[model samples]
Target: MENLSLGLMLMAVGMITVFSILLIVIYLSKLLIAIVNKVAPEEVAVKKATATASAPTVIDPNTMAAITGAVNIVTGGKGKVMKVEKI
Candidate 1:
Protein backbone atom coordinates (compact mmCIF):
# COMPACT_ATOMS: atom_id res chain seq x y z
CA MET A 1 0.00 0.00 0.00
CA GLU A 2 1.12 3.64 -0.55
CA ASN A 3 0.81 4.35 3.17
CA LEU A 4 3.19 1.48 4.02
CA SER A 5 5.79 2.79 1.56
CA LEU A 6 5.48 6.34 2.99
CA GLY A 7 6.01 5.02 6.50
CA LEU A 8 9.13 3.15 5.48
CA MET A 9 10.51 6.30 3.81
CA LEU A 10 9.87 8.38 6.91
CA MET A 11 11.58 5.79 9.14
CA ALA A 12 14.69 5.83 6.89
CA VAL A 13 14.78 9.66 6.98
CA GLY A 14 14.53 9.70 10.77
CA MET A 15 17.35 7.14 11.15
CA ILE A 16 19.58 9.10 8.77
CA THR A 17 18.98 12.33 10.69
CA VAL A 18 19.88 10.69 14.01
CA PHE A 19 23.08 9.19 12.58
CA SER A 20 24.09 12.54 11.03
CA ILE A 21 23.64 14.39 14.33
CA LEU A 22 25.68 11.76 16.22
CA LEU A 23 28.54 12.00 13.72
CA ILE A 24 28.50 15.81 13.92
CA VAL A 25 28.78 15.71 17.72
CA ILE A 26 31.69 13.24 17.60
CA TYR A 27 33.53 15.34 14.99
CA LEU A 28 33.06 18.56 17.00
CA SER A 29 34.39 16.98 20.22
CA LYS A 30 37.48 15.69 18.42
CA LEU A 31 38.05 19.16 16.89
CA LEU A 32 37.78 20.88 20.30
CA ILE A 33 40.21 18.40 21.97
CA ALA A 34 42.75 18.95 19.20
CA ILE A 35 42.49 22.74 19.55
CA VAL A 36 42.96 22.59 23.34
CA ASN A 37 46.00 20.28 23.12
CA LYS A 38 47.59 22.52 20.47
CA VAL A 39 47.15 25.68 22.56
CA ALA A 40 48.00 24.21 26.00
CA PRO A 41 51.80 24.29 25.74
CA GLU A 42 51.83 28.04 24.97
CA GLU A 43 49.40 28.72 27.81
CA VAL A 44 51.57 26.76 30.26
CA ALA A 45 54.69 28.62 29.19
CA VAL A 46 52.96 32.00 29.75
CA LYS A 47 51.84 30.92 33.23
CA LYS A 48 55.32 29.71 34.18
CA ALA A 49 56.88 33.00 33.00
CA THR A 50 54.37 35.05 35.04
CA ALA A 51 55.03 32.96 38.15
CA THR A 52 58.83 33.26 37.81
CA ALA A 53 58.56 37.06 37.44
CA SER A 54 57.09 37.35 40.97
CA ALA A 55 59.50 37.85 43.90
CA PRO A 56 60.20 34.82 46.07
CA THR A 57 58.65 34.91 49.57
CA VAL A 58 59.72 33.24 52.81
CA ILE A 59 57.39 31.07 54.89
CA ASP A 60 56.99 31.54 58.69
CA PRO A 61 58.20 28.56 60.75
CA ASN A 62 55.09 28.76 63.00
CA THR A 63 52.70 28.48 60.03
CA MET A 64 54.70 25.58 58.61
CA ALA A 65 54.62 23.78 62.00
CA ALA A 66 50.85 24.29 62.32
CA ILE A 67 50.21 22.92 58.81
CA THR A 68 52.46 19.92 59.40
CA GLY A 69 50.80 19.30 62.78
CA ALA A 70 47.31 19.37 61.25
CA VAL A 71 48.37 17.02 58.45
CA ASN A 72 49.98 14.63 60.97
CA ILE A 73 46.84 14.70 63.13
CA VAL A 74 44.57 13.95 60.12
CA THR A 75 46.85 11.15 58.87
CA GLY A 76 47.29 9.80 62.44
CA GLY A 77 51.10 10.03 61.99
CA LYS A 78 51.00 6.97 59.74
CA GLY A 79 53.67 8.35 57.39
CA LYS A 80 56.30 8.58 60.17
CA VAL A 81 55.40 5.18 61.70
CA MET A 82 57.69 2.28 60.77
CA LYS A 83 55.41 -0.27 59.11
CA VAL A 84 57.83 -3.23 58.76
CA GLU A 85 59.81 -2.65 62.01
CA LYS A 86 62.74 -4.66 60.70
CA ILE A 87 64.91 -6.01 63.51
Candidate 2:
Protein backbone atom coordinates (compact mmCIF):
# COMPACT_ATOMS: atom_id res chain seq x y z
CA MET A 1 0.00 0.00 0.00
CA GLU A 2 1.10 3.61 -0.58
CA ASN A 3 0.44 4.54 3.06
CA LEU A 4 2.60 1.73 4.34
CA SER A 5 5.46 2.71 2.05
CA LEU A 6 5.09 6.36 3.09
CA GLY A 7 5.23 5.42 6.78
CA LEU A 8 8.43 3.40 6.29
CA MET A 9 10.01 6.24 4.31
CA LEU A 10 9.18 8.71 7.09
CA MET A 11 10.63 6.43 9.73
CA ALA A 12 13.83 5.93 7.75
CA VAL A 13 14.20 9.68 7.23
CA GLY A 14 13.74 10.41 10.95
CA MET A 15 16.29 7.74 11.95
CA ILE A 16 18.86 9.05 9.47
CA THR A 17 18.33 12.63 10.65
CA VAL A 18 18.78 11.66 14.32
CA PHE A 19 21.86 9.55 13.56
CA SER A 20 23.52 12.38 11.57
CA ILE A 21 22.75 14.92 14.31
CA LEU A 22 24.22 12.65 16.99
CA LEU A 23 27.36 12.11 14.91
CA ILE A 24 27.72 15.89 14.37
CA VAL A 25 27.37 16.55 18.12
CA ILE A 26 29.97 13.89 18.99
CA TYR A 27 32.50 15.27 16.48
CA LEU A 28 31.87 18.84 17.65
CA SER A 29 32.46 17.90 21.27
CA LYS A 30 35.75 16.21 20.37
CA LEU A 31 36.80 19.31 18.39
CA LEU A 32 35.96 21.60 21.34
CA ILE A 33 37.98 19.46 23.75
CA ALA A 34 40.96 19.43 21.41
CA ILE A 35 40.78 23.20 20.93
CA VAL A 36 40.54 23.93 24.67
CA ASN A 37 43.41 21.57 25.48
CA LYS A 38 45.59 23.23 22.83
CA VAL A 39 44.70 26.76 24.06
CA ALA A 40 45.27 26.02 27.78
CA PRO A 41 47.14 22.83 28.47
CA GLU A 42 47.27 21.25 31.94
CA GLU A 43 50.13 22.30 34.17
CA VAL A 44 52.63 19.92 35.77
CA ALA A 45 52.51 20.01 39.57
CA VAL A 46 55.77 21.07 41.28
CA LYS A 47 56.63 19.58 44.67
CA LYS A 48 58.35 21.98 47.09
CA ALA A 49 61.15 20.67 49.33
CA THR A 50 60.30 20.58 53.03
CA ALA A 51 62.49 22.39 55.59
CA THR A 52 63.18 19.10 57.46
CA ALA A 53 63.85 17.13 54.28
CA SER A 54 67.42 16.31 55.35
CA ALA A 55 66.52 15.55 58.99
CA PRO A 56 64.98 12.22 60.00
CA THR A 57 61.50 12.31 61.51
CA VAL A 58 61.05 10.88 65.01
CA ILE A 59 57.82 8.96 65.73
CA ASP A 60 56.16 9.17 69.15
CA PRO A 61 56.36 5.99 71.24
CA ASN A 62 52.57 5.72 71.68
CA THR A 63 51.83 6.41 67.98
CA MET A 64 54.42 3.89 66.88
CA ALA A 65 52.97 1.27 69.22
CA ALA A 66 49.43 1.92 67.94
CA ILE A 67 50.51 1.61 64.28
CA THR A 68 52.42 -1.60 65.02
CA GLY A 69 49.47 -3.07 66.86
CA ALA A 70 47.04 -2.21 64.04
CA VAL A 71 49.32 -3.77 61.41
CA ASN A 72 49.70 -6.92 63.49
CA ILE A 73 45.96 -7.25 63.98
CA VAL A 74 45.16 -6.63 60.27
CA THR A 75 47.80 -9.10 59.07
CA GLY A 76 47.03 -11.74 61.76
CA GLY A 77 50.47 -11.17 63.38
CA LYS A 78 52.21 -12.14 60.13
CA GLY A 79 53.33 -8.59 59.19
CA LYS A 80 56.37 -6.77 60.58
CA VAL A 81 56.79 -3.02 60.89
CA MET A 82 60.22 -2.44 59.34
CA LYS A 83 60.01 1.36 59.01
CA VAL A 84 57.49 4.02 60.12
CA GLU A 85 57.80 7.49 58.61
CA LYS A 86 55.76 10.70 58.71
CA ILE A 87 54.57 12.01 55.36
Output the number of the TM-score-best candidate: 2
Against the true structure, candidate 2 reaches a TM-score of 0.45
TM-scores of the models, in the order given: 0.44, 0.45
Model number with the top lDDT: 2
> What is the C-alpha RMSD, rounded to one decimal, of candidate 2?
7.9
Give lDDT tens digits, candidate 2, residues 1-87. 999999999999999999999999999999998887788654421212333442567676898999999999999999999998777
The digit string of per-residue lDDT tens for model 1 on 31-83 reads 98899879765878877775665335334458567767777898997644222
Quality of model 2 by C-alpha lDDT: 0.83
Alpha carbon RMSD to native, model 1: 8.9
Candidate 1 residue pairs in backbone clash: none
